[model samples]
Target: MIGAAWRRTLNDDRSYHAINLNEFSFTVPIYAYQVEGEGGLSLIWSRPNRD
Candidate 1:
């Protein structure tokens, strides 16, 4: 695995979130969303778009 995260629940939406530690030693916020009909969660992490 590239990195690991500590799962947590949100108080507002009751959704899951975490802080991702990448292999490069950078920490980024990641969010977990439930997949439709799959009964699974997908982690999403992205950087701000600069145009």
Candidate 2:
């Protein structure tokens, strides 16, 4: 099984400030022979427009 999740952070203006993420999680049967690897994970941020 494979899955992903996400989280969001708010700024002082009560707007979206940044997005946090978790890498995909996988589950495999014991008999299945497989090699697993991971890549760089990152967070994206944006500034809120205050009018």
Candidate 3:
């Protein structure tokens, strides 16, 4: 699904020039913190790997 979206973006009509993203990988920052909830403080952390 991600690959299909990437292909669509590359072929989008809004883009005038070609876009080539080869051998690329993207990583979002892992945040670890706490949030105050109605039941007091709650834990917040990075999402575990899904695959």
Best by lDDT: 1
By lDDT, highest first, what's the ranking?
1, 3, 2
Leading candidate by TM-score: 1
Tens digits of per-residue lDDT, candidate 2, 1-51, equal 332333333454332223322233412211111222254343343333433
**What is the Cα-based lDDT of residue 43 in candidate 2?**
39
The residue-by-residue lDDT of candidate 3 on 1-51, one tens digit each, is: 112112122244532222222223524333344444479765455634636
Q: What is candidate 3's CA lDDT for residue 8?
A: 24
Clashing pairs in 2: none
TM-scores for every candidate against the unseen true structure = 0.36, 0.22, 0.29
**After aligning candidate 3 to the native by TM-score, how far in Å is the CA of 25 from where it should be?**
23
Off by over 4 Å in 3: 1-30, 47-51
lDDT of each: 0.48, 0.30, 0.37
State model 3's lDDT.
Answer: 0.37
